[model samples]
Target: MSQIKGSSADQPTNAPLGALHDIRVLDLTQALAGPFCTSLLGDQGAQIIKVEPARGDMIRYAGPFAKDAKTHDFGNVFQNANRNKRSLVLDLKSAEGQEVLLRLVAQADVLVENFSSGVMERLGLDYERLSAINPKLVYTSIRGFGDKVGGESPYGHWPAFDIVAQAMGGLMSITGKNENSNVRVGSGVGDTVPGLYAAFGTMAALLEAKSSGRGQYVDVAMVDAVLAVSEVVVNTYDATGVSPQPMGNELRGFAPFNTVAVKDGEVALGAPHNPQWSKLCTIMGREELITDPRFDSDLKRWNNKTEVYEIVEAWTSQYTRAELTEILGGKVPLGPVLNAEAIFADPHFAARQMLCEVENPRTGRPARITGPAVKLGRTPASIRHRAPLLGEHSREVLLEAGLSDAEINRLVEVGATTINEEQVLIKESAVR
Candidate 1:
C-alpha cells in the first residue's frame, strides 16, 4: 500500500444545495459500475465516503497518466467515476476495519457495493448484517447477473465485465453492420447503464425508507440493465418472430435515417417523415424525388432505401460536414459523427457547459472532464470536488464515526487502516 493524501478541506464551502445534500453514502465499490452509482449520488450533493482497500481502487493504476505522476492514485478511469467523493482506506477483511464500517453504517443513508455475489457474505458484511446495525440503511449491489435478493440467475456466481454483459444482454447482437459482427458499444454503457439504474433504485429505496422507517436491498444486474435499454431488440424479435440485426447506421423502417458519406466525413441525417423528407429533398436539389412514386412516402422510400441512400450520398458527397450542417442543421435531424477533437471545439459544449475544468490538487494543474448531464433548475448536480488520495480521509471519517485521535492512530499502526500525515489530493485523469 502507498501513502497518499486526501480530505474535503480544499473544496468550495459555499456550494449550492443539491437534491441529496442530506444523504450520506458509504461507497464500497470500485472500477466502473459501482463507483459510477455512488459518483452520481456524490454529484447530487450526497457525502460519499468511498471505502477502499489500503492500496486504493484497482482502476487507479489503469491509465494514460499525467506527467510526473507519483502515486497510482490518479488515473483517467478512477477520476471520472470517483469525483465528488472522499476516500477512506480500510482492510475490510480485518475485524477492526469491519467494526469501523459498521459504525459508519449506523448513520449513513445508504451503502453500495459491487463485489462478486458471495464476497459480502464471506466478509460478514452482507445487507443482512449491515441492516442489523442500521435498519434504515439502503443497501444496494451491482452484479453481472441478478443477485439472489433481486431474483437469482443461474450465472449469479460468475464474475462478469462490460463486454460480457453486452454480449449476454442482446446489445451486441443489434449494434453493428450485420448479424456476424457482434459489436460492443464504443462507450462503457454495459457497466454505466447498470450503475445509473442502481443509483435510481437506491434513491427510490431511500425515499420509501424515509416514510416507512425501513430500508430494503436494491440489486442491479448489468445484463438486465443492458437488456432493458435495448428494448428495440426485444420488441422486434417478439413482434416479428425474428431477431433484429445491425443495419449499420440506419434506423429500422425509416428512410434517409442513416449515415451518409459527406466530402470530409460521415454525417447522420434522419428526415424520414413526410415534411422533413420533402424539405430534405428540396435542400438536396432533388425536388423531383419528392414526387417520384418509388420515393414518395416514408414506406416507399424505405422499400427502395438502397436507391435513396445512393442518391442522398451522391448529393452529400459533394459537400463537407460543415457545408451540410450549414444548409440543414436545425431543419433536419442531422449531425456529423464528431470525434473527440470536434466535440471539444464545438460551441455546444461551451454553451451547455458540457466540458468541466477541474484542477489537480496534487499537481496544481488543470484538466477537463465531462460535466454533469442532468440540469435541474433549482438543484442541479455538479462536480464540486476532485477524486481523493488513497486513505486520505481515514482519520477525518473515523473521527466522525466516533473514534478518538489515539484510536485512529492505533488502527493505522495496526494495519487495520491507513492515513497520510499530509493530505495529498490524488487528482485522477479524465476519460479523454
Candidate 2:
C-alpha cells in the first residue's frame, strides 16, 4: 500500500450525548439497507465515518432534490439514510486507499458493510484480516443471502435488492389482495429491516467482544430478516400444511379485522374480540348479530366473515371517515388511512414529535424529516446534522485520525482524495 496523509482541525460540538457516543463506526456501506443500518448507529451517537468513493455514494445523485440545491448531494432517500455521518472520499481501487482503510480499521470499534459475500475478501479486508489488526473490532456484514461468517447460504453468491429479498423471503407471498397477484411492500422494509437486525447484532457483538476481548463477524441476510418478520406465513404453513395467501387488508382468521371503506376514504377496523364485537354490533344498529349463531362467537364470525363483513361495511360505508372517527374512534379500534398531508397535520404526530425539522443546506431553511422512533429518557437519539456533501469531511477526518497537513495535501495532490466543506451552507439566522 502507498503512503497516506491527511489533517484535521477542531471538530463540531453540537452532537448529542448518545448511548454509543464512545463508539467509532467505519461505514463502508451504501444504498438503502447498509446506509440505514449505519444511520441507526449514527442516531445513537456513534461517530460514523462514512467511507465513500471519489465520486461519492452513488445514491447521492438520486433526484427529487430540494428547490434551492443547484448542486444536489442527494434526494429524499439518501438524505433519510445518510444523516448524522461524516463523509470520507477514498478510492479503494488505489493501493494507498486500501492502506488508509486498513489503518482506520485498526482504530475503529465497528466496521459495517453490505457488499456481496466475497467483496471484502477480494479487497483483502475481510474480518479475519481486519480483526488481526484490531482484535476487538465488531465487523458486521448485511447482505441478501448472507456471508460465510455464520454459515453460508446456498444463494450466498447471488446479488439481491429489496424486492428480491421480499420475494424470496416470502414477504410478497402474503402482501397482495390475493395469492395470484403477490405485491411488494411499498416501503423498503426488506432492506431496512435487515439493517435494523444488523444494528442490533453489531451492538450485541460489540458487547460480547468487550467481555471476551475478541471480536466476531456479525452477519445478517436481508432474506432472513424478512423471513423472520413474516413468520406468520411460515408458521401457518408448517402447522397446517397449507401455504398462506394474501387476504388484502383483512386478518384471514379474524372477522371485522380489516380495512373498511367509508364515504370519504378507508379506515382500518378491528373488533375481533367478544366485547368489541358486541359493541360494534350495537353501534352499527345491528344488535341482532349479538345472538345470531353465525356471528355469536369469534370463531363463528370468522367462519362466516363474508356475511359479517358485509353487515359491517354497510354501516361503515354510510359515514365519512371523519364522521366514523367521531362515532367509533374511541369505542372501536379504528384509524383512518392517513396520507402524508394528513400525517403532517395530525396532532398525534406533532405531540409525539414523529416529524422534526432540520437545517437544509439547499434552502438554508428548516426541512422536515422523520424523527427517530426510539426515545430514551436518558441519552436520547437525535439528528445532529444533515447528510454531508461528497468528500465533505475527508481532510478533517484524516486530520482527526492524526495525519499531518503535508500528508493530507499530498493525498489530495495525488488524485487520491478530495475535500469540500462549503457543500453544507446554513444561514446565520437559522436556529439549530
Q: Listing every candidate in turn, what is its Cα RMSD in Å to the true structure after a full C-alpha superposition?
A: 4.4, 5.3
**Cα lDDT of model 2 by residue, 161-280, tens digit:** 999999999999999998888999999998999999999999999999889999889989999999999986889999999989998987757888999889987899999978999999
Worst 10 residues of 1 by lDDT: 1-10
lDDT of 1 by residue, 1-432 (tens): 111122344566556568999999999998899999998898788999999998789888887567756654688678778888888999999999998988999999999999999999999998888998889999999999978987889999999999999999989999988888769999999999999999999999999998999999999999999999998788999999999998788778898898899888888899898899999889888899889999888899899999998998998899999999999989989998888998989888887777776655555566567777787789988778678778777888999989999999889888999986445423233212
> Candidate 1: misplaced stretches above 4 Å?
1-8, 422-432
Record all residue pairs in model 2 with backbone atoms less than 3 Å apart, i.e. clashing: 5-407, 6-408, 7-399, 8-399
Q: Can you list the residue pairs that collide in candidate 1? A: 5-424
Task: Give the 10-residue window scoring lowest on summed lDDT in candidate 2.
Answer: 1-10
Q: What is the TM-score of each candidate against the true structure?
A: 0.93, 0.92
lDDT (Cα, 0-100) at 180 in candidate 1: 81
lDDT score at residue 55, model 2, on the 0-100 scale: 77
